[model samples]
Target: MSGGEGGEEESLEFTPTWVVAAVCFFIIAISFAVERCIHYGGKLLKKKHQRPLFEALQKVKEELMLLGFISLMLTVLQGTLSKMCISEKFVTNMLPCSISDKHKEESAGNNTATMEHLGGLRRLLSESALSQTAYCASKNKVPFLSIEALHHLHVFIFVLAVVHVSFSVLTVLFGGARIRQWKKWEDAIVQQINDTDPSLGHAVTPIHDHAFIKDHFGGIGVHSSILALMHSFCKQFYGAVTKADYLALRLGFIMTHCKSNPKFNFHKYMMRALEDDFKRVVGISWYLWVFVIVFLLVNVNGWHIYFYMAFIPFILLLAIGTKLEHIISELAHEVVEKHVAIEGDLVVKPSDQHFWFSRPQFALILIHFILFQNAFEIGFFFWIWVQYGFHSCILGKVKYILPRLIIGVFVQVLCSYSTLPLYAIVTQMGTNFKKSIFDEHVQAGILGWRAKVKKKHTLKGSLTKPGSSSTDGSTVRIQLGGITQKDAGEIQPVHD
Candidate 1:
């Protein structure tokens, strides 16, 4: 190439579209990381505290930051890309000519100058016009429905933000009330215990027996589970709900157990039922729906970048849902039947063991693998889109949409792959929470049974009384469940 040609090549201007793509990609990556941290933190905290509503509020704050950052990054990137040069071919071949003021002063008649300006203006209009997908792909490069879609997306997120804030306030109120109520009842129980048996009674029960309260309130799970359920219930009530059968099925499974417990308290039953509903909604419904909608929109627009944003979350939602189903079904089976240990690693009951080899568990693993593969396909598609878009943009193929499509896909795949780990981490964290309850305390049973037994033993009367004379005239320790007396007194079996 000659020096002049080299200079021309160096000086040749093109749109800075990659900047927009990069911004979007980074935003998605950061958001996924934040989301993972939030879920992991929730799991760690849920074990320590029963108030999940506070965690939900914290999640809302994180999501708000994500939305704000995404919106701002997209806006700035779009503005930068819009200012880059239109292709020279596009300017010369398609644009209308401008009417020079000098030619008009010279009365150059209806000739080349006027026609040139009109031609340049017409070509500008043509190049700027875009189909919805291409328009969105070329965002600021074109004029069309992309603006409306962008506006709508932001508007939807704003509405979501408002909803989150409202829910956060409601959660605080509900959690405060619930905590206060729990304290009140706990105090009453402690007072009763103190009045009846002065030795063992305390204001709060021992923390070591928290397993009892956990069983009563519902087992450990994501704080999002409860919030997700409340969101689903409102959605169902307002006729915006989906996955209705899944919700009902979970409810049925829980209620089946309730029917066998005639002494079940209504308040406890309702609280537990709601908690279960929340668990299902969070693991399966909320993230899954978000993934589907984002994927469908990306597909319809043919934008590779959006697919990247949608993919990992899509895979994660499926994986987490499968894990949850396995854990829940396994626990449900465990509750209904008593099983004997077969090997140290296995339990055998009348029905089959519901471990990894079981039909349901195998199916769940298969489903997770399938979702993972689908996300991989999305990454491949995004790569192809980006490669083609960059090539075409440099080659000045302004008339074709394929290049822009490729770039969008490239952005999608790049962004999705980078954040895939975070999604996996969050999904695994949620699964771990569900699994922890099973691992630590499945056969732990309710504490009230032991409490009742202790009461009965205490009422049987002291076998040794202070300063009471023993029949054998010897000091003996009086052990209730054993034959021992510490004082010099005969074993008392006084009538009640």
Candidate 2:
């Protein structure tokens, strides 16, 4: 009877290897083709003036990343299901041996004999035939491949394909928005020039003719603005500014003018504001790169190692998010300072200090990190646990699920609450450093002298005027700061 049962189990365990292989091949081929199209299409759109095509490709890339993430999650679910099914089958086969022993004992009407028979049977099966039966039950017609191994490989390929598809999406959304915003700003500046001085309206040169706008407002405007803002803050702290600081201050003024103007697209205004700072923090850390590479290598080897490496990306992402918060806080502080300087009577309130974080863009980024990025990270590892058959036994299931649940809760809390503390630390450190420098300058008697000299120079420069300040037969002089006094006065503060 046992032999017949074993044969039936073996027959039922057959896995269609060719079908799985063909499906995997098709998936890989399709993923490769789609990825190639995204890559070359992005490049082609970039070279040409195909704004719509480029934007479409960028959107497609983001969607692909989302799809890849979903596919990986599904792979994990499938893996868990397969393991559970296999384990349940093993438990079912062991049940018959126990049932037969109970029947024999009941017929004999002896409890001790029944117990002895049960023990003997169990021992015999465990010591000899259990391995053979399990091997047979697990085996399929796929040469040396067992059903478990085949399932694992198929899930692995599916995950790989998803990952490839995700990374093929490019981050080009910000570029197109930037160009459109600049063109609008140029038009606004040209209109302002024509409105301010009607006599030279016919001779008012194009926006590109303005050297300051062309040099600073071209492509690297955000970068220039950040550097300029940082310099201005440094100058305010330390009365005597360096050449670098002065240039940065000039850039900051230009950025503020562009940002404060009502004619420009505020949504696309400061898209790349914190991008450079993010790159600076993440790129300079060589050890993080090494960790990333090592984790990838381990992930490719097998599920066991991949399980540990899975959380590394989440941790790195959280770190990046925290750094971004810090950058935003710094930006907010600088913006408030600029406002206070421009509107001399305006006071900086505690609420104004946190204004940047409340902005639509910052809020959107925060929501994405919490709702999308963190959730994806948690789902990914949850899938990993389920996929590797770690949840089969009671002990294994507890070991796999319990710690990860706790970790996930902890990670969520950290990502959400830790941003403010990190931001505070960064700001506090800068404040302390600036205070210390100011104290040193005061003690050396250089602070007061420098302030007086700057004040006197400003007064003299404002009163002085050049006679030949004309461009293209237009008497409307383009100030070195990218805006005349009247234009500056007309500029409004950005509400968002």
Candidate 3:
């Protein structure tokens, strides 16, 4: 027994000091080296691809700024509203007259001493007991709900409405700014390309082949065609253009594609525009719903049963829905792949692999379903709150519910309808903003330099007629809209 005890004590001994120190030192050195390498690599990447890095940084900054603004607004709203609801005066005003009077009377009496005596001599003779009782006799007399409480609750709802409306407005404004910026950049890039290489201008086809696109790829097809076109275009013009010009060409292609295949339906367009925004908002609202649900279940009797009733069926439905969606997605992918293969379109390949289900994708889908269900549940709870408060009003004593509900519904409808207009406004704004910035910073300087070079070249060429042939026997002709004019009288239009 003595030997076994001694062995157990030895097993429980701590690691030696040198061993622990060495391990920690190794970890620190490795971490420092990794950090330095990462920093150096990032700088190298930024130097090589300055434009892309700048754009990415700008995007991240904008997103973070938006997130920070929203968080600050929410924090202020919660703090102010909570303070108002929990104030002593507000709590006291919320209590009923009868309860207030009873509480006052109970507080005036010395009931603690009587209760202490009734506990027998053993309680009264405790050496450590205080002369005054610590318990509050009137603690239970306070009412949970009062007039002030109802008022504050209405105020909270109004604040939430205001916040939602403000968010929508901000989103619209920011989107517009981004659109304005993009448009300026596109115009500059187009002008630069036309000036430098007029022959290449013919490649910038007006994207009006909507019917052809739809027939070939179906609705909102994968970006394989665009990718293929970009690859071929870049390869053909390799080393002939600057990085900025290449970017501009790609942007032009995308814009042309979008303009040609416009979604005519307003609702569909709105849905697509707000899809990412809605997903983010819904994610936040789901977290709020979870907190509310937990609070309600803990404070109110029988609430857990209702939660179970809703949650169980929702889980079952979600499983069925996800499975159905998976099947449909697989079928669509297979059909697209088969069509592409048969057409022998070597320029583009179908993206069937991207549609395959993976662990991470499945997890994302599950989260989406949870958020969707939570939104419904939150709305249902709000309705219940309204109904309960309305029924408890007792002949218009609590008169705020109807007006609050009406205002909230009206505001909600207005915001919902404004989504499409907001999207259009935001798009336009962003395009304009992008164009202005690009012109002011990049295009203006380059255009000025090009103008001087062109002027010198024109002076040298002025000795001969504009349409005169060179030593190589090739005639000098002007090309406009993909049509070359050998002579003014022989000019003719070219059709696609």
> How does each model score on lDDT?
0.36, 0.38, 0.36
State the weakest 10-residue window (summed lDDT) of model 3: 127-136
- What is the clash count for each candidate, in the order shown? 30, 0, 27
Estimate, for each residue in 1-496, the C-alpha lDDT of model 3 and write its tens digit: 2253323222214656787789899989995885576456557756764333334333433443455565556556643432232323434432222354545545743368544543543232221122111111133233233333434344444444334434434433443343344444445645664567434433322222322233223443544655433332332222222233223223332343232322112222222333333333322344554754554444323233334434532443334333322322232334445453332111121122323252213332443333333333444446445433333221123343344344434333322332222322223111111111121234355346546756656775777687884342223232211123233343111111
Off by over 4 Å in 2: 1-154, 160-262, 269-293, 296-318, 331-496
Over the stretch 50-114, how does candidate 1's per-residue lDDT look in tens digits? Answer: 33333453645555676688688767765444444343334222111122432453365346754
lDDT of 1 at 261: 30
In candidate 2, the residue pairs with backbone N, CA or C atoms under 3 Å apart (3 or more residues apart, or in different chains) clash, namely none
**Residue 38 alpha-carbon offset, candidate 2, angstroms:** 8.0
Runs of candidate 3 exceeding 4 Å displacement = 1-144, 196-496
Which candidate wins on TM-score?
A: 2
Q: Go through the candidates in order and give the C-alpha RMSD of each one to the true structure.
A: 21.7, 20.4, 22.0
Q: Candidate 2, overall lDDT?
A: 0.38
Deviation from native of the Cα of residue 90 in model 1, angstroms: 20
